[model samples]
Target: MADATKNPIADLSESEQLELSKFIESEQQKVKLQQAIHQFTSTCWPKCIGNIGNKLDKSEEQCLQNCVERFLDCNFHIIKSLESTRK
Candidate 1:
């Protein structure tokens, strides 16, 4: 991927360049995380809640909460398991 940090504005001041690079990297990471969350939400919402007509009902909301919680739990467990297996 092209480094956006190489532009003239970023190359102007040393501190500004570093700060801009960090900001760009952080924003890219944020976008990636947002995309992942959106994908998970899209898949999980349908699995947890059947059909959607209007605003999310209480039951559907509960299901979404459960989906998020379970997804995090699964991610945590997977990371822990990987660490152990790497030993």
Candidate 2:
């Protein structure tokens, strides 16, 4: 586990950097998105694709789109509420 205040990725050493490069190349073969987007997509994908199936249904596809929207909405609501309370 990493410290909450510090970035763990920034602490990688020379050998660790080389290893990370290899790992990232392997991951890139499967994913087009960057690290953060990949993480978000992976988390949201499971939420949207809870069960193994031949393919995603229309509802599951909608869930993937809605998941991103809902996350943005929640962030906006929290910011607005906090601003209102501070006033």
User: Which has the greatest lDDT?
Assistant: 1
CA shift of 4, model 1, Å: 14
* Residue 14, model 1, lDDT: 84
Question: Candidate 2's residue-wise lDDT over 1-87, tens digit each?
Answer: 656999676789989988999999989865754664675587678788878789988999899889877776886899999999999
Q: Largest TM-score belongs to which candidate?
A: 1
| Candidate 1 ranges beyond 4 A from true positions | 1-10
In candidate 1, what are the lDDT values of residues 1-87, reduced to their tens digit? 887668678446888888888999999999989997997788687777777677888888888888888888898899999999999
Clashing pairs in 1: none
Distance from true location, Cα of 70 in model 1, Å: 0.4
RMSD, one per candidate, in order? 4.8, 10.4
Ten-residue segment with the worst summed lDDT in candidate 1? 3-12
> TM-score for each prediction?
0.72, 0.43
| Candidate 2 overall lDDT versus native | 0.82
Candidate 1 scores a C-alpha RMSD against the true structure in Å of 4.8
